[model samples]
Target: MNSERILILIKPDGVNLGHIGEVITRIELKGYEIESLKVTHATKDQLHKHYANLVDKPFYPDIESYMTEGPIVAIIATGTKIVNVFHRMAGDTDPSKAAFGTIRGDLGREWSDGLLRNVVHSSDSVESAEKEIKIWFPEK
Candidate 1:
């Protein structure tokens, strides 16, 4: 099998809620090598580019706002089929809907603010992983 790399972001909620260590632990435990990592306060330009597909949508502003609320941990993990594997690890976008053993399912919640607030973000496919990896780790 060909090795793959993925962009994984431990969102503000995940960092703020003290799940960074837990999240990274799970990744390591899964046997993927973390290629690079950083703690960053996202900029609007970055967010705009990252969510360009969603920018024209009505709720784009909400996403931008939520993302800027705190610092996020950006990660690049490498392994065979890491993109798809990490997606499963991240679980559902809605924590309440994720399975019990998944990251979001175990650590995230259906917040009172009614926001998605899922703990992590992972590339959905190899093509997307390439595009997204550039956005978050341009220097790579």
Candidate 2:
């Protein structure tokens, strides 16, 4: 049997707001298996590597600042097409614009800090998911 693994980050906002449990619950209820989980502070190198494509962008610093401010829940979820499905469950990047019943719509809120704080981050593709899994869960 083939299984897909995805990297899902419950961002600082999600962590600070105490949505980790709820987020995990949603993932579990959706029938995805969490292979690994942790609450950790991301290092600059890791963040830079993770968002390497955005490193040169003007908004990258804000993301770095926000991501480093607090601990985030790092999750490795596995299932068939887990990457695609979790993206839908995570909703849009803008919480306010996300549809109801999604994790963002139900528990996320907008912050004045621009896009630095949304709610979560999910790998957009299976290929990307593998790369991201190494970033957040290098040992695995």
Candidate 3:
């Protein structure tokens, strides 16, 4: 099988809630190798660039604000079909709706009056991974 490289972002809320270590451990246990990792605050320009595709989204501003609310950890992990595998590990985007054993399922919270506040982020596909990797790790 061809190996896949994905960009994973542990959002500020997740970091503040102390889910980063557990999330990384889960990723490692899933047999993914950490190609790169860093903990830094994402500037507005960075977030704007990262979520450029979502600019047309009605929730774009909120996403941008939330992303830059605090420090975030960005990780690049590689493994066979890692992108897909990681999504499964993340469960649904909404923690309340996520299945058990999934990261979101285990560590999700309510936002905007009980809306989804799932922790962690995994690239949805290889193409997306490539695009996101560039946004966060342009040097690579």
Candidate 4:
């Protein structure tokens, strides 16, 4: 089928706050195909590797803590232009100023100190999507 593929990581907070189904529903409603999915606790090593890009950022430690706090649901969705489309639906990383109707804007909370605490993560580009897919689903 020639569908562009993308990855979605429903964060710890999202899963803990009971938004997994809602988030999945929104994605499916947008017409993406669920290629592979799983819900599991993230290991410290996986967290470190998955977020290696942010390792030098100041907020890296906090992000690492939050991600490892609980279990996350990882998913691989496929569709035409799924990467770009998913990012649009996910909204800005910081949800406060995100436009309405986006997942983050609708379900996210304001950050008082520094963390965005957005509901999910979507790959930023095709290369990133491919790399991320392997990180999250190496067996695929």
Candidate 5:
């Protein structure tokens, strides 16, 4: 069976707020299999590499700090079109605009910090999925 895989990172806010189980539950409920999972505090280097595209942005510092503030749950979910499915389930990057049933919409809210603390991150495309899965789960 050919299965697609995506990386899901439950951000620091989500972990700090105790939403890891809920997030995993949502993914499992959608019929995707969780192939691997881990909870670890992200490093400055990892965040820099992960968000390299945004490294030059003014908000990058806040984002990097927030990501390193607490432990994050990194997950690998596999299934048919799992990347797109999980992204849809995670909702928009801005919780304020996310749909009601999505993870962000159900559990997130706008923060005054301007960090868009939207609970989770899912790979946006096949190429990104491959790259991110390697970053988070290199042994795979």
Candidate 6:
């Protein structure tokens, strides 16, 4: 089978709001296979390294704190063009601007909290998918 794998993270807000199943269902319904899954709390070091490119950004601290707030669901989904497909399913990073029917569009909203709380994160490209999958599921 010719398939590509992408990493999907159901962030703290999504986990706390209990939207994990819904998110998984959406992915499955889209014909992607769940290759691996786990629910765990992220550590500061992991997040910092995961988002190393954004480490110097002003919102980096807020993002780190938000990611570590609660348990997150890390998923590895596989299918053709999985990276692009998953990114579209996750919707725009800004919920306010995301098109309706996407995971974020339907379940996410601007939070009073300063950090962006979009419900999910999906690898944006093939290279990113490889890098992120290794980071989240090294055993794979």
Give the lDDT of residue 15 in candidate 6: 93
RMSD of 3: 1.5
Q: Which numbered prediction scores highest in TM-score against the true structure?
A: 1
Clashing pairs in 1: none
Residue by residue across 1-140, what tens digits does model 3's lDDT show? 99999999999889999999999999889878999999989988887777778888888777877777788999999999999889999999988789989999898867774433567888999998999999889898
Model 3: residues >4 Å from true position, as ranges?
112-116
Question: Global lDDT of each model?
Answer: 0.92, 0.90, 0.87, 0.86, 0.88, 0.90
Predicted structure 1, TM vs. truth? 0.97
Compared with the true structure, what per-residue lDDT tens digits does model 5 show for residues 32-51? Answer: 89999998888887787788
Q: In model 1, which regions exceed 4 Å deviation?
A: none
Instruction: Give one digit per residue, the lDDT tens place, for model 6 in 34-127.
Output: 9999998888877877898999998898898889889999999999988887898889999999999999999999988657899999988888
- Could you tell me the lDDT of residue 59 within candidate 4? 83
Clashing pairs in 2: none
Q: Candidate 5: misplaced stretches above 4 Å?
A: none
**Cα deviation of 73, candidate 2, in Å:** 0.9
Pairs of residues at least 3 apart in sequence or in different chains that clash in candidate 4:
none
- Model 4 residue 36 CA deviation (Å) reads 0.9
> Using TM-score as the measure, what is the rank order of every candidate, best first?
1, 6, 2, 5, 3, 4
lDDT at residue 13 of model 1 (Cα atoms): 96
Worst 10 residues of 6 by lDDT: 40-49
What are the runs in model 4 whose C-alpha is more than 4 Å off? 111-114
Residues 4-106, model 1: lDDT tens digits: 9999999999999999999999989989999999999989998998898999999898899889989999999999988888999899988999999999999
What is the Cα-based lDDT of residue 86 in candidate 2? 92
